[model samples]
Target: MLVIRGLGSQYGRISVLRSVNLVIGRHQLIALVGANGAGKTTLLRTISGVQKASSGQIEFDGKDITQLRADKRVKIGICHAPEGRHVFGPLSVEDNLHLGAYSRADKAEIAADLERNYAMFPVLKQKARLPAGTLSGGQQQMLAIARALMGRPRLLLLDEPSMGLAPLLVEEIFNAVTELRKRKITILLVEQNANAALAIADQAYVMETGEIVLSGSGKELLGNERVREAYLGI
Candidate 1:
């Protein structure tokens, strides 16, 4: 559904991503795992059109979108749930979710999707009128993902969804991700938790110093000696 070829990005003269190539087939969950500075988030930002590519190509369903604006990309079915659950602090939970579908005019579908999101995160329904900032970290993350789903994204980009949550919350978030993939939402998950990410991914890529070092089936990378020693701490 998406293809990135020889993609590169930089912050002024400092290069952050170099020749990054990846593909996400329809209905697949692809994980990008690396250390803190490995540029996984940069790659996602570039693909989502928030970070401009210094070089290379980004194609979605056969059309080039390398130069498309961020909002345009979202309208084209690319939605990003950023690292920090940057929910609108003063907005009610329901209001925050409604903003996700601001690009669409289909009120009936939007209402149905809102209910779907509420069903996915029952706490959201309970806190429908509460300020987003009042929710716990885990609940905020749930709201973030739920908000993105409100866009009816064809390709969801998730960066560090489990970042600071408790173990149980992390499990809940990951399980929700798995369910999304099962429902055939194509996802590109950028995670620091290598073992957990690889465990759930249909495919996985290992990145180092702004370059992808290895690509394989998730289980294959999970059992790899180098991956075990470096990322998994095995």
Candidate 2:
């Protein structure tokens, strides 16, 4: 449902993503695994239109969106849950979620999706009236993902969803992601946890120094000698 060809981006003169190419079929979970500086997050940001592309093309479904405005991209069904859990500190948890649906005008569907998000993260429902900053780290992460869902995204870009969470919370978050894919959400997952990301991904890519180094089935990459030694520490 999404295609990126020869994608390149930079932070001023410093290049971050170079000649990157990737595709995500409908309802597929595509995991992108790489080290901290491999430019996984930059690739996602460029796709979501938050960061401008220095070169190359980004197409969603079919049309080119390389130069689309960030908010327009969200309206076109590209939603990003960024690296940090940047929730509105003073807003109520429910309000933050409501803000996600600001681009849409379907009140009935928005309300229904609100319940769906609440069901997805019961903690958010319990803390509906509380300030988002009051929630625990794990809960805040849940809120971030749930808020993104409120936008009714077709292609969800999740970056470091499990960063800093406890092991159990990490498991919970991954399980929730799996559930999301099962419901036909196409996802581009950028994760530091190689093992977990590869295990759940339908397809996976390995990036090094701003370019794709390997692309294969998730299990194939999981068992690769180089991948095992470098990312998995096996």
Candidate 3:
């Protein structure tokens, strides 16, 4: 469903992503795992059109979106749940979700999707009237994911969904991600928790110094010697 070839990006003169190539099939969950400075987040930002690529191309469903603006990318069904769970602090929970569908004109479908998100994250429904900043970190992450779902995205870009949550809450978040895949929502997850991420992904990629060093099925990477030593610490 998505193809990236020779993609490169930089901040001023310093390069962050270097010739990164990847392909994601429909209905698949792909994980990208790497250390803190490996440029994983930069790749996702570039793909989502928030950060411009210095070189190479990005195609979604066979059409080039490299030059498209971020809002235009949203209209084409690309939604990103950023690493920090940057929910609108002053907005009510419901209003925050409603903002996700800002590009769409279908009220009925949007309402239906809103209910679907509430079903997925019941706490969000419970906090419907509260300010988003009042929620706990885990709840805020759920709110972020649910808000992205409100956009009815075809391919969801998740950046560190489990970053600051407790272990049990991390499990809950991963389970929710699995459910999204069961619903056939394609995902490209950038995670620091290699074990948890690979355990749920269908395919996984290892990134080092802004380049893809290895790619394989999730199970394969989980058992890989280098992966275990470096990322998994096993």
Candidate 4:
């Protein structure tokens, strides 16, 4: 469903992504795991078109989107729930969710999807009228994911969905991600929690210093000796 080839991006004069190549088949969950400075988030940003590519090409369903505007990308079914759980602080939780569907004109389907998200994250329904900033960190994370789902994304780009949450909440978030997989929501998850991410992914890639170092099925990478020593700490 998506293809990236020799992709490169930079911040000012410094390079962040170097010749990164990846592919995601429709309805498959793909995970990209690496250390803090490995440029995973930058890669997601570039693919989502929030950051411009310095070189290479990105194609979605065979059309080149490397030069498309970010909103245009949304119209083409690329929705990103970026890292940091960025929710509008003053907006009601429901409003934040509604904003996700801003690019669509289908009110009936949008309403249906809203209910679906509420069913997925019950707390968001409970706090429908509350300010997003008042929610707990885990609650805010759930809000972010649910908001993204409101866009009815074909390929969801989730960045650090479990960052800073408690262990139980982390488990909860991962379980929700698994639910997305079951729903056939194509995901390219950029996660620091290598174990959980790789375990749930159908296919996974190891990124190092802005480039893909290894690619394999999730189970294969999980048991890989080098992966265990470096990322898994086992």
- Against the reference, the lDDT scores of all candidates come to 0.95, 0.95, 0.95, 0.94
- Tens digits of per-residue lDDT for model 4 on 1-234? 999999999999999999999999999999999999999999999988999999999999999999999999888889999899999999999999999999989999999999998898899999999999999999999999998888889999999999999999999999899999999989999999999999889999999999999999999999999999999999
True-structure lDDT of candidate 4: 0.94
**Would you estimate the TM-scores of all the predictions?**
0.99, 0.99, 0.99, 0.99
RMSD of model 3 against the true structure:
0.7
Per-residue alpha-carbon lDDT of candidate 1 for residues 177-198, written as tens digits (9 for 90 to 100): 9999989999999998999999
Clashing pairs for model 1 are: none
Model 2 per-residue lDDT tens digits across residues 86-181: 999899999999988989999999999999989989989999999999999999999999989999999999999999999999999999999999
lDDT of 3 at 26: 96
lDDT score, candidate 1: 0.95
Query: Candidate 2, clashing residue pairs?
Result: none
Identify the runs in model 3 with alpha carbons over 4 angstroms from their true place.
none
lDDT of 3 by residue, 103-205 (tens): 9999999999999998988999999999999999999999999988888899999999999899999999999999999999999999999999999899999
